[model samples]
Target: MQWVSLGDTGSSCPAARSTVAAFRSWADSYLTQPSDELGRDGPVCPYVQPSIRRSLLWLAQVPAADPRPMWVRAIVRDALEIYPELPTRNGSSTSVLRALITVFPNLKDHTLIDEIHAEFKTKFVERGSMLGQFYPGCDQPGLWNKDFRPLDAPLPMLVVRGMMTTDFPFLLDKPEWADAYVRKFAPTLPAHVRSVMVGRLTSRPALVPAYEVRPDDESCSTSS
Candidate 1:
């Protein structure tokens, strides 16, 4: 919904700008739909579809050094909100996550997705009867074990990038540059949360040698 001027149009072609405008229009139309009517509508709701489109557009617009904007969170939340059946949205979450990764590949780490999954579990799953709201035909534990599990690895990096970009500024002195740094890393962190990513990336412990194995190493074998 936020509109910023495309400064320095010299480098961009007219066709490209037109395409961008078209995409934005499409997204705007999608987000404006009524939530109550989304279910009776079908697989592709006008509201939800535009959010997905907007997500992709925003991701393309992001600079390599800058973290994604806070607006992106709302965009994603809106996308998820349109569907009545949790299963449909939950399943689409995977696609959404994948789209994010395609934009920011560094977010391939499972740790980030795990955090999002945990939040979903705490927010929705803990409420017992909320199960039907997410998935129509499936049970809670089954959905958790199946769809949600596989989704963790491939979730979109852009979503994590947006989270970090939006939150990191309040936590640091050089908020602007720090946001850029966080985006570059595609870290799954809030603005104020200190990330272990740098430490993990830089620090390596000396590897100890494995115990020498003898040719007839009976100790190594387990007795049947």
Candidate 2:
């Protein structure tokens, strides 16, 4: 995990400084609101306000890491055009997140990067009795099926971190996403982890075909 300086707001325009304040405000109280729509309760979110406030700037201005151990290493960006003028979405909430990957696709522990973006998207679109307000472009139903998700978020933001081996089960239902998962993670996974993924993937006919594994193929070998 990277060291995170919680209360530091390096240099910023007056406007950006204020935006950070607004974000922190939301993170403190608004995020804690009990939303039957979000399945969120009054308990403060574990992500914490300071982390969200400084993360956008941190991407550009991350100083050398401190020599001490840290609790969490994460990246965040505001897509609302509200603060720090980070990045405005052309409609898709995920545009900023995907753009980040396009710019720096390879990072240490690629798992964290994939995990955060993928989970956020999934959580936003999820529609049960629990979550319904996560939709992004409310006026534009063309962006997503209205029957399922209207796609709206109170604050447009994306948090990113490495993907974890435990998250493979969630990706198995999405073919393109699953293939990307295999490409990014299969190369670095522990031998045991790889073997488990191969076993699980072979039974998931809906998603396994994209990896194109065969009994004789070396590319998908668990030993590799």
Candidate 3:
């Protein structure tokens, strides 16, 4: 379960070499470039280029030929444990750009990918991280374009990254999740954006003004 740099080819899994190659190709051709389908002005993932340049992107391949749910869960838990130790540039400002992509090369049961994502998402979010599921024929649509499946990828995989201010959409519907988001980013968000977030919360919690909190303190004890 060791995480490797994108160029590493030392894995023992039979498909690991090819699967990692495919991921690298996809990343260079699709993720690092902008697409009309995205309905936006930048690369598919705006952080990807910087992640690559800073050498903060790492990949791990699950060796199971036919992965079981319990095993995949275990792998995901391992990944969560490994994420915080990943390297970054400029500290917190660029740490959100860091990513760990865990690939399931031989998994054919794509539905299990979704299940694993649902099971681990809460834990990841509470730790100030986001978990994303990606697989072929994935139907999860892009935020800006309904027809675009930004989550779709050639192989089944889960990705983890430090949550960013732009993740409000994912947090807005759930009160607890929204509170976590506010506690993490409230000090950095624009006033209008904070207003919009407050308006969208289902049950708004009284947020202590950011000024009252120490600048180095990223978490708000009162918000939780």
Q: Candidate 2 lDDT, tens digit per residue, 1-224?
A: 12222244555434344444544565466554443443334433333333344342232222222211121123332321222233323453322221111112112333333344544444322210011112134332311223422233343333333344444555556655455566656687788867766777777765656544556665655785
Give the candidates in order of TM-score, highest first: 3, 2, 1
Query: In model 3, which residue pairs have backbone atoms overlapping below 3 Å?
Result: none
Ranking by lDDT, best first?
Answer: 3, 2, 1
lDDT of each: 0.31, 0.37, 0.80
lDDT of 1 by residue, 1-224 (tens): 32122232344445445434443453345333433323343332232354453432222332133334344334334323422222223435322211221122233333433344333422221221111111112122222123322122111332211222322322232323333445444544543344443332223222211222336755667775
Candidate 3: where is the Cα deviation over 4 Å?
7-15, 89-94, 202-224
* Alpha carbon deviation, residue 30, candidate 3 (Å): 0.6
Q: Model 1 — TM-score against the truth? A: 0.21
> lDDT tens string, model 3, 79-121?
8888898766676644887888998877888888899888888
RMSD to the true structure for each prediction, in A, is 19.0, 15.3, 7.2
- Indicate the TM-score of model 2: 0.36
